[model samples]
Target chain A: MTVQDVYLLSPEISLVGLALLVMAMDLFVKRKAVLFLMAVVGLALPVALSVMLWMDVQAEPGGRLVGVYGALTVDKFALFFKFLVLGSAALLLAASLDYAKRLTRLQGEFVGLILLSATGMTLLAAATELISIYVSLELTALPLIAMCAFLGSSRSGEAGLKFLILSGLSSALLLYGMTLVYGFTGSTYLTEIGEAMKNPLDPSVPFGGLVILVGVVLMVAGFGFKISSVPFQMWVPDVYQGAPTPVVAFLSVASKAAGFAVLLRVFYVAFPSLEMDWALLFAVLAAISMTFGNLVAMVQTNVKRLLGYSSIAHAGYLMVGLAAVASRIPNGGETSALGSLLFYLGAYTVTNLAAFFAIIGIANKIGGHKIDDFAGMAKRSPLLAAGLTVALVSLIGIPPTGLFIGKIFLFSAAVESDLAWLAVVGVVNSVVSAYYYLKVARLMYMAEPASDEETPASSISLRLALIVSALAVVAVGVAPRILTWATDAAASPLLP
Target chain B: MDLEKFLILSAVLFCIGIYGVLARRNAITVFMSLELMFTAVTLAAVAMSRYVASRQVLANPGDASEAVLQTLLTGQVFALFIIVVAAAEIALGLGIVIAFYRSRETVDISQANLMSR
Candidate 1:
């Protein structure tokens, strides 16, 4: 509402403007390459603005800024995700050039929708109130649903429809839960709800404790769908396999990251009073997701479907950090659980983007989704094959990869929080996951080509994206201090 | 009507909506059920807002009247947002369904198993 608030929201505003600009330009322009360049170039403004906001947050003594009547907050936490979302959008756009070109008539809309979704994601991280969070979440998802069906294939249609129905159902569940919390607390603000729940306004409101408990549980279920955790993960393989490869990559990383961003904010900010029970609940969900995702992934022949299952497994690993956050609440020492969660998300984003970009490259060339299609890939395109191999290795948590370091921090957080059993589950699941991931690597290196023809080379933009993401993965793996510091700063506002 | 009666009605509607979503085969029918669920949420939100308003009046008469109104308005605002979002969701849902129907000549979800393992 104030001038300063406008300044604080500049990053999101610029993204929206960019989306509208891209759509408007689509009508005037015929060249898809020009539009892609415009989108990629426009993304730089938001990244720069987010970094400025980071400086602003640091300048402030408390390391936080609340704006727009307390509906949005700008802190290291928000800034961290703003950078991640913007970075992912740029990378995805770069990787999607070829895919978008194939759509022909819908290329403009594809790029425009991605920008719109990225705007939603950036806002979702900054939202501090429940209403704002819900609105931003819907904004994040609707375009993605549209994008899921962009291919016009029967499979794409199925993916879009399934995503729509399940997402709608989850939104309803989440809304009902929010309504219950509002009804009981007389507020829609997360901090207000937290304060209200700390001491009941009126204890005679029927089954007060039970009602709040149910509300929290339903909200968890709603968010569970977003992050693709167990029991709500049925849509993952289907949607991932059927949606455009770039869109799947976007969903697997950015969408899940935004989901966790909001999840952490809501649970830590609104439901801290219920930490013990929710923490335990997340711990159980974490174990199930890892075990189920890894085991199911082992049998998948479709490379996309395999990544889908692997993403679910990664979600399980992330949930272990969530559970640790809960268990550590009582002792309240160093809240590394949340810091580790943020760090892991950052690392996973880079690593998964690398893997998905490689898939996009290979799929665009070979025009196949089966893992066997990747046999002899190294001979055809060494850069892509090596990039994917490194990415898959990172995913398996091997040394000198971003995910390896991420897993170390996550499991250590679990152990520090006295959830050693959860850490053990995570370790076992990671080992189990290595089997399928290595299988893909083996196909790329050791197996014979399914055909005599060499696979076509990837586009220059895609190769650039692959290399950048891969380098980031290795950089973060070798030297995690920078990201760790950022994650720590991001996590501080959420912890007490 | 009492608050409990309104809540009970909303709960019944919600359960029916859930049953429809789970049991319905047609895409359009499933979408209708999703709308039904949103309606249930709207009803509950309104009833809860009224209940909270009454409780506020009873707890502190005349002094905190503005606070009571503000609290009631928040719930109504939530319901309003839900309604708008539900409309958007259904629009997109039906569009996707139409697209699916065009490709497959059917809307029965049981038959839409092209991606199933």
Candidate 2:
């Protein structure tokens, strides 16, 4: 490969290198501050790399190279996700430093794995070939499985094991489907499959589109598990409950966004013709995931599990955008709906992350993660309470919140696609979501504190992350033009 | 000895693997069942590759084409990929099992409910 080809993949290369550097420093260094410094630098470097790569992608039209012979991709869609993934990692790292020192000692490895997983997620968005996507997806999953168990003695281990087995099963199913698709198309390159599928009416092709459709369904199911959509989301609550708050937050926002990013790319580029099949599937998955998640979340006493169900509900809402992209809009046309969906994903990620940051800070202070533990939080810590309220209100799709705008865009997309019933179901679920979010808010504001012993103090770094995320949530909510532009730029798949 | 027979065998194996994964109680055994499913996919992929290659050879006799060789190679490469992934899965899968075993003193998933509400 040429030097330029190598340069195109530098963001991923740098992340791998940075992960190793942190690990090596962990081995040699004994000082906590040194390790903390390494992690902060490690986290900051990716953001710099992402910005450089984004500029590279924008400056050089068609600069992306299909290195390793059509497997890896270096494209605008990849760059967009790389930026978001890296940004999320940075936020998690910033908050995690304090949590790590207080809760656990393996700060170096924990931060390193999060960065590595972020790298894997970036590749998942960029992968143009099936095998590359499969490997990268595993790369993403393995770290998360390990991270879930990193708490040493918590239920995180059990949750991690369950996640591993179920996710592995999904991977096997996905691989079989991919192999079947390769058999039918004679090539694993998505564009080649698109071309092969163009002559959908050709009878000479051995298995009718039925087999290929099955493959697509399996692939979508695999992705659905990652995004915590219905029928594939049984693992979410357990995993979230077991994992540390920061890791849970990472999984809910960044990992979920990465899954959606790939889903958008695969359907929009590789299987646009098969939209008639998958659109209906997504529509149902969307409705079930959102409604069930919201309803189940209403009764959750554990804050982590409640957020887990809320994550699932948000996944359902995101799928509305996916359905809109996959379905044909009446008067608004096709790609326009897709652009809106992308915008919504970006907005949703920021808002979700903001909510989780507040939770993590609260959990750290109170020495508990239960919803009941949050009673009289507004009186105890007004700043955190205010931040969390913003997050919860945003999550409930209240006006003047990012999630409200995201829901608006998603519903409009669905309506434009003549999916009024789907949009209506989504709205109902939004109402359902409001109850759980308000439950937490009510505990903080209305309920009297049990005792002075129940109250907890917050840390400075954790406070900073909460404030930053809260500001981001409001900023994105109030002025969505920035996200809209970024999402619009990323709507078109970076084809090789 | 034709490719179709191999594919049929793989399909049957795949079904059996699924049954084992669903029915088995031991975490290790369930993980092994998952490996069986992966191997079945490898068998199907190789068989399909052979079918495609032989068809190409018969249609263009005496060519011994590089393109056909690459087509077969894709199957072999993917098979290798599956094998590597299965190994990694086993490594992680067993690690968690060992960790859980240390705490619960049981390999059966039913007894490992210390975390479950």
The DockQ scores of all candidates, in the order shown, are 0.80, 0.56
TM-score of chain B of 1: 0.92
Write down the lDDT that model 1 would get.
0.89
For model 1, the stretches where C-alpha displacement exceeds 4 angstroms are: B64-69
- lDDT score at residue A396, model 1, on the 0-100 scale: 97
Which portions of model 2 miss their true places by more than 4 Å? A61-65, A102-105, A200-208, A329-332, A454-456, A493-496, B55-69, B115-117
Give me candidate 1's TM-score against the actual structure. Answer: 0.98
Clashes of 1: 0
Clashing pairs in 2: none
Docking class of 2: medium
True contacts kept of each: 0.73, 0.43
Evaluated at residue A98, the lDDT of candidate 1 is 72
Q: State in Å the error of residue A315, model 2.
A: 1.0
For each candidate in turn, give its C-alpha RMSD to the true structure in angstroms.
Answer: 1.4, 2.4
Worst 10 residues of 2 chain A by lDDT: A328-337
Instruction: Point to the candidate with the largest TM-score.
Output: 1
Compose the digit string of candidate 1's lDDT tens values, residues A9-83.
999999999999999999999888888899999999999999889988889988888999788988898899999
